[model samples]
Target: MALSPEDVIKKSFSATHLRRGYDETQVDDFLDEVVVELRRLVSENDGLRTDLEDCRASRGVASGQGAAAPAAQGERHEDAEDTQELEALRRQLAECQEARAAAERRAEEAQERVGAAERERDEARSSLEAASAGAAVGASAAGGDGEDPSSIISLAQRLHDQHVAEGESTRARLIEEGDTYRTTVVAEADERSAELQRTGQETHDRLVAEGQATHDELVQTGQSRHDELVQTGQSRHDELVSTGEQTRDRLVAEGQASHDQMISEAEQQRSTVLEDLHGQESALSATIGGLQSQERDLRERLRAFLSDQMERLDGSRPTS
Candidate 1:
């Protein structure tokens, strides 16, 4: 099974401790790095596995053609070498399968971690709501006694300050996570490129060696089988290279398209959010203005009532 980021981090820490002394904060930072690297590695591994599978399928078709060709002089001998190559390819395929499985497991674990993070975020939101509600209640109670307007205003200010602080903290955490994720993705891409280059080189060497062997055997026999093998090998090699390049190009184009789609979606969402915010602001302003108008009317009515009472009291105090 694939190792999770946490598992990878834990393993790294354990190994590091055995080799060196323990430092809690350092270990924690290292673990964070490990998680980033492990996620990158898993992503690259998945891509590599997909490419390898495509290569193998292409190779299978070439192998079928190679088998159908007539057995010429020393062709039987070449068959043994071909068998060896096939076995090697099988081994490589098995290794790729194992790696793919590991990567899939790691991906599942990563998803779980993401789900947990989402849950935590939800909990934090709930906590924030509760805190805001509590603050509102406190402010209402304080305002009920008109003698402490200053205290009520102070409480409201404190609530605003707390909310701003919490928002800043959340934004900082998101920024840090984004940075780490970007770094990890870049590293993973580099690693995958290096691996692909190495694999390509090895495949090229094997094909060259096979061609040389066939050419030598054909030299001793004559032009018929030699020309046939050379032609077949060249054709197959060209086909594989062309097809692989086209596939790679197509994948790249698809990826770019997907990225563009995501960007467009994000822009749309941002625009929607901004529009909603603007609407909310307008509504809030209107509500506040309405409330203020009502308060003014209420105050005027109170003044009229107090004035009338004072007039009555004045009338009651005769000759004053």
Candidate 2:
């Protein structure tokens, strides 16, 4: 496996059987370099990620408003964006799941390492116990050989000190390893979460701005179109009304002329009929007067003739 800064910093060596472990100055110098490199890499990666996210956000916004779009087209664009967002969410979720899985694997590996370390510690403890028992037995044997009691006690003390020092070193190493792994895991997770949050926020802001821009554009276009339609309709209505007025005026004038002609013709016919009646009445009256006069003259003649006939009869016949 690749060694990270934490691993390098936390690396430990077993207590030497004959000499001290690794040189502390050399180890510290190497760890410092590793830590600086790790920091530089992390900073560079974070910067690159931020730049990439910003570029993507900018491109998405530019593409969204690159052309004049209708409302339906804009809705389709929104749906497409929603779909893309859902896909991105799914991808992010998958990445999170993968990261979680990786963390779990790391946790398992860490557990294994801890178990191994614990086992090693237990073995070390057992070895120390065994060594103490051996030293006691040796001291007892030395005492049986008539050795000095002070020397035996001093050997036992030396053995105890060595075992204690070894145990302390092993414990410290284990603690440092655990802390390093924990810090690395937690730092990585926090960094990833922060990056995701920042990217999501940027994307959201860009999308909102683009949507607002599109909405304003559509509203303006619709307003202008409505005004144009209204103007056109008003114009058409005015033209129709003017045409209707002209037709009405023409029909009214024609009707008036026809009415006047009919009235004049009727007046002329009435005058002619009245004059004919008057002339007929006058002729009848004249004929009636003449007939009356003739009747009177005939009556007078008849009376005279009757009288003459009577005289003649008187003359011709005997008087009666």
Candidate 3:
């Protein structure tokens, strides 16, 4: 089951309510680029298929005519030339298929990156939750301390969850877009190929009709034309492949860099939140210690006052 462009456009993610997450605009922009690149790849694939079909049809017609014609040394030489041309065409077609496969591989890689980012985000969220739970337990152990630290921890947890959720959502969206693009490109290529086949059949028939009288001359001319076309196609294919590779590399690099930056920032924020919590806990402990000291001093003072009063009372009783 392949996702189409419409599916990508309709894809949505769960909102991270009350949390800050990835920038929606940036995510959307990146998706748009993926769609555009997919479209370009599809178009190129279709064109390459058309060219391959044309070359095959041309070869078939040339072979059929050669079989019907008189076999001379010159004709044999021409046949050999035709065979070479067909071989070149086959090689070109193979190269085209390879290029298409490479493009698909790149799309898969993009999805893999999306998966990695999601995994990292999930890990971060889990770790933060664990840390928050730990802090809560420590606070409880310290005589069920005040709500301030707990509240702060709660807020930090929410923030962490929100950020992680946003990154996850963005990554999911990107994966969906890639799936959709791949499906759409393949379908379009198939349709274009069928159309090209029909067109090639009609053109082959016309060429056969035209070759009846001027077979030798046309063969020579066609060889020259075929050579020219093959060279041109090769050059064009090389340029397209080079450009596509460069674009893919740049996009992948940018995505990775962005992901790393986001993770680094999130870690820093979590560390800061933890530090604040620890500092507050220390302050509370010091205050409790001071209160205990004051309590002990008060107890000693009261006992001394009681002893003094008793002595005065004894002294006042003369008969005793």
Q: Which is the leading candidate under lDDT?
A: 3
How much is 248 displaced in model 3, in angstroms? 92
Backbone clash pairs for candidate 2 read: none
lDDT tens digits, residue span 256-284, model 3: 99889877877777788789989999999
**Model 3, position 200: C-alpha lDDT score:** 51
Give the Å shift of residue 118 in candidate 3: 2.6
Worst 10 residues of 2 by lDDT: 55-64
Cα error, candidate 1, residue 166 (Å): 2.2
Pairs in clash, predicted candidate 1: none
Candidate 1 lDDT over 8-35, as tens digits, reads 6556323421223335697578568757
Displacement of the residue 12 alpha carbon in candidate 2, Å: 99
Error of 2 at 102 (Å): 3.4
- lDDT of all predictions: 0.63, 0.68, 0.71
Candidate order by lDDT, decreasing, is 3, 2, 1
User: Predicted candidate 3: what Cα RMSD to the true structure?
Assistant: 48.2
